[model samples]
Target: MSTLQIGVLFGVVTFIALFSGMPIAFAVGGVALTFMLIYMPAETVGLVAETLYSELDNFVLLTIPLFVLMGAAIGKSRAGGDLYASLNRWMGRIPGGLGVANVMACSVFAAMCGSSPATCSAIGSSGIPEMRKRGYSPALAAGIIAAGGTLGILIPPSLTLILYGVVTEQSIGKLFMAGVGPGLLLTALFAVWVVIRFRQEKARVLAGDESGATREILREEGFTWREKFETLPRLAPFIGVIVIIMVALYGGWATPSEVAGIGAFFSLLMVIVIYKCWRWPDLKAILGGTVRESTMVMMIIATSFLYTYVMSYLHITQEVAQWLVALPLGKWGFFVAANILLVVLGFFLPPVAIILMVTPIILPALKAHGIDLVWFGVIMTILMEMGLIHPPVGLNLFVINSIAPDIKLRDIIWGTMPFIGLMVFAIFLLAVFPEIAMWLPQNVK
Candidate 1:
């Protein structure tokens, strides 16, 4: 068969397989194996084995499991609940403040755990029920979390950024630095949207456009400063973890792997000591969750590299790069096209798979256009955040639905719809002014 025919078939069949409900690792691995056998000679099959081995051979990949363990330990602990309580007391005094606080808490928790589903689960567990009881609408409660949870991937210590670093060979520390500005920008954007929605609701009530019960919510009871400070000791340990990671990375005191190791150990220790999660089962649960998540990511990474190998062998990668360069579209035009492709791939595949599998094919074009890998990494991570809130495979959406079973899937979907636009606007802002994501990474010593 012709190379073009092979390339087209590969995408179509892979899409069908991925969308068919099979495990992502199997679907991706299966595609790689099938194509390797049919197109290449039997001897080339050995290369597939070699490719799988080399993919996981990097020392930097160690960061992923360690970070995952840190997140898992936190996820299994009471730190998340404490953090939410602290923020709510301080930020929840205003009408819709709880929702804003949820966004803020999600951003904080995202730094604690780089996994989106973990962020969604942790914050939504406490945030949702609390918001509902305090007169917050179910849609507002669920939507805020589903949208806020995307912060997990954009903020520092993020797995998506780690994976992007691994694939693109960008400086992980610099990438982490790059994420800070955009992360805060998105957090503010999400919070601002919440504030506006509440204002609109209050305006409606004043005009008798809606019910008046929301007025009482608008007059939410305020907490004293002392009360706000009281919850800090409970949360200080978790915040300390974030500080250690930041200082370690920014201070140049440790490599990404070393920082992850230290952070994970301390996070585990903090939970055990402060949260008293010392029982055998608690330890077992944290370790087991870490292994499960880390293994799944490793499996995806392995198959994605193999698929990348086949793409290169089929001349698909070279063809695509050349095709991209041939476009009359300039640099900005390329960004537009690339963003669209990333969004579509994100809808079907998780960020990890897309990063590993797609990056190799497009790297040449990025260099040709002189696009900053760090900048592109932040953009890609933001797009991945959108995918987590988006449909058929929206990981965060399902996470919210699972935790808050009372909130229907449709509502969660609706709740996330606006944030998608917000993310798009973020991408726009970053594109127009690259400094938003680059300034920190560039200026920091």
Candidate 2:
């Protein structure tokens, strides 16, 4: 078969496997193997081995496990709960105060934990219950947590940024720096939406005098500043971990991999010594969980390698790149088209899968058009953030809903609309003013 025909077949097989509920790693691996066995030489097996080894052997990939372990340890240690409680007490008096706190807490946690589900699981566990007790509708609570969860990808230390840097050979440190401003911008937008919603609710309640008497609320469950300060110390270890990693990376003292190792070590130490949250038995369980999660991610990476190999071998990526570049659109047109395509693909594939599959093809076209890669990475990360909240298969929606089963899927979907609009606004800002993502990376060090 012609290489083009082989590429077409590979694409079809990959789509089928993805929608059929098969694991992404296996899907990519299986499709690649089929093509390699049928069309390539039998000795091509060596190439697969080489691809797996080379991809996994990277120093940067170590950061993934370290970041994952840090996130898991913090989650299990209940530091995140403390952080949220602290914020809640301080912000709770404001209309939708708890909701605003939820977004703020998630943004803080996202800086430390780069995974979306981990962010959702950690914050949703505490934020949802607190908001529910405060009389916030489960839908509103779930929606806020779900949307806030997506900050995981846009914020610093983002695994998605790491993967994008690794795949595209961009500077991971620069990518992390580039994300800082945009991440904060999105978080601020979410906060504004919360405040607006809260004000509307408060106005309606006062208009009807539906609010309970102040003494009644005080007697029932008054706000407590005392608990807020008491909970502040519990966040120290997490803060320490983040500071160490960021300092190490930004100070040129350590590579991302080395910093990840340091971060993981400190995280383990914090859980065992500082928090006293994990004993010997709990340590074993945590390790087991980390292994399981790491293995799943690694498997996906391995399979994606196979898929990338086959696509390259068939020249599909090259053909697509050439085709895209030949189009009449200029740099801006290509940027818009790429964003739209990624948003569409994100609905079906995980961010890793989308990045791995499309970037190899689109990046060449982007560079040929004189686009800034760091800027593109930030834009893509924001688009992927949107994907996590989008319908049909948004990972964040499922995560929050899983924690708050009382929330209907429709409610979670509807809540994200405003946040999604904000994200689109951020994307436009980045596109029109590339410096939003580029300025820091350029000026820093």
Candidate 3:
């Protein structure tokens, strides 16, 4: 069969497996194993073993579990509550203040916990209801959280960025640096959108209110200077954790793994000290979450490597690359097409799987087009962020639905739509001015 035919068959079978509800790791591995046996019959076992072992045999991979642990410790505990509560008190005095505060909290939490669902869950739990109580429409409240949570992958110490760097053989630090600008930009955009959306919702509420009950709900119960300052003590530890992580990365004080460990340890200590969550159940929940997430990610990474190896051995990736480059489109046109495909793929696959499986196949074409890998990493991370809030596989959407079951899934999806547009606009801005993502990575030591 032609390499094209084989590649088509490989993708069809893999998608079928995935849509049929098979786990991603097993599905990818199964298709890969099947193809390997068909192609390398006698050498299938050896090839699979070798590829799997070599791909994961990196010290840097340890950072995944440590990062997961840190997020889990904070996310599974009261740290998220503390983080959100403090921000809420400070931001609650103004119109749409809760929403602006939610965006800020999500951005800071994203830096600490590199998991999108975790950030969504951690922030959404309190943000949504509080917004609801404060007369923020349920859909808008849900949307703020579902969208803000996506920052987890675009901020530094991001898992998706780490995986992208590893798959593309780019510097993890540079990828992290590239993300900082876009991350902050997206955060600001989310906040701005929240303010706009809040005003719209407030107008509707005021117009529709027959009684003053709705107005009362929208009323701001002001916090005193002392009350706002009281939250600072509760929030300082989480801030300290973020500062430590930033210092570790930008200061060149430690490797990624070391930073992950330090962040995890401190986050754990904060929960235990503040929440007194030293019970075995608390520790067990944290460790259990860490192990499950780490194992799932690692498995997907391994299977994706096996899938890549199969494609490479069959010359499918090279053939695809040649095909992509031969298209009549110029580099910018190529980017538009590639971004469309990545966004579509993001709708179906998790960022880690896409980073591992799709990146290898596209790397040659990307290099041929003179695209910077760090910039592409940030761009792809934002695309994946869209996926996190988008439907079908929109983890953050479901996370919001779970947190605020009173809010319908459809409404939650609607809520996140505006934020999705903001992400697309962010992409457009980056395309027009590449420096938005490149300046930090280029100028930083």
Candidate 4:
């Protein structure tokens, strides 16, 4: 009967609806309406319409579709192959070179695409086959792609960070800037893990272990300087896109929305011009996919506003915050518990849904503890990044498996475990230093 009890009951119902095969937008919106009609005054029904309209009216949200469109165009084009070709020419001679190149390519592609599955699909389609050809195990190849792909949500221009910014009322640009350090940190960790795996496998191969026996130890010949230079042109379009977006954003030349539009246009233009692989069918498919994906994100955003509305009216955030703050757990103890809960949730939920659903409930507590929203955005994005590589619901694992069907899902999951550990290590670094994520955002003009 009390507001808090009703709010808690509504949350339970919403989750049940989600697990029972209802769409997230529908589940959240339907539960919210059901509860509002029962508990809120009839005169307050207008709040639902107002909340829906205002949420969709946001100018920043336009970036979501544009970024999705840009990613679709790039992913549909030859950029992935070009990226792998160029990087492989340089890195292929190193131990586990193709895997290293895969991580690098994913990081670069993440900057351009701003999506996990897109990065996984685009890179894995090319990288997995190449690594397999070089005698890399299918599991290691698929795992690298799956884990590397998660950078899409943590790198600059990330949709996850954008949504987090919108939900927490933080600056989107600052969140993007904050993501760069952590993104690169994860990339380094993954790359290092690849090298360590390479060494271990090499030692096993020398010991006559069957599993590692067929693995290639080195490239037959290093590329000539001329050969290396020849491959560099393939990456020009990708590099140009990254430079334009970064300079436009950090140099104060444009807003995030404006840059997203520019990036989308340039991505399409590159596919048609530089790649010269454009076709009417591909364009149609890209647009169709963009429409579907963007619509899903928009619907969630629109409905989440209603959920936020109900919570606000009921003062649920305040009550929860009071409870959390009253706990005997200190700041560190509270964060440890929160991180564990998020990691568990990461196994079951999509990143966008997690942000929309959990953020409102947790923001008040985080704010009460003086946790900086921008810093927490980076931390939360990393955890969500892990979710994309986590098994069962780790969407990127499925994406990679779909691209490289010969590799078993469990093998891919196994390969991802080490990277998952690296991600956790990155989180630990963020927790201890804080400034790793905060320094840039705070120092930026």
| Residue 321 displacement (Å), model 4 | 2.0
Q: Per-residue CA lDDT of candidate 4, range 343-393, in tens?
A: 999888889888997888888778777788898889899999889988668
Collision pairs in model 4: none
Model 3 lDDT tens row, 284-342:
99999999999999999999988888899898889999999888888898899999999
Instruction: Score each candidate by Cα lDDT.
Output: 0.88, 0.81, 0.87, 0.86
Over 4 Å off, model 2: 1-3, 206-228
Please give the lDDT score at residue 91 for candidate 2.
76
Question: Model 1, range 1-445, lDDT digits (tens) per residue?
Answer: 8878899999988988888988899999999899999998899997777889888999999999999999999888888888888888888576678888899999998987888899899999999998777656667788899989889898988899998898888999899999999999999999999988777765665576545244244435488889988988977887788899889888989988899998999999999998899999999999999999999999998998888888888998888889998888999899899999999887778888788888888889999998999999999999999889898788988899899998889888887888999999999999999999999888986
Error of 2 at 36 (Å): 1.0
Task: Give one digit per residue, the lDDT tens place, for model 2 in 1-445.
Answer: 7767766777788899889998888877888888788877889877788888888988778888788887777776667787787777777666677899899999988887787888899899988887766656555678788889999988888899988898889999899989988988888889988888766655655566544423112111337767666766776666777889888988888877787788778878887887676677677666776787788888887778778877887788888888999999998888788888998998888898898778888988988999878888999999999899998789999988888888788988887888889899988887778787788889976
Candidate 4: stretches off by over 4 Å? 212-221
Better of 2 and 3 by lDDT: 3
Model 1, TM vs. native = 0.96
User: Local error of candidate 1 at 299, Å?
Assistant: 0.5
Ranking by lDDT: 1, 3, 4, 2
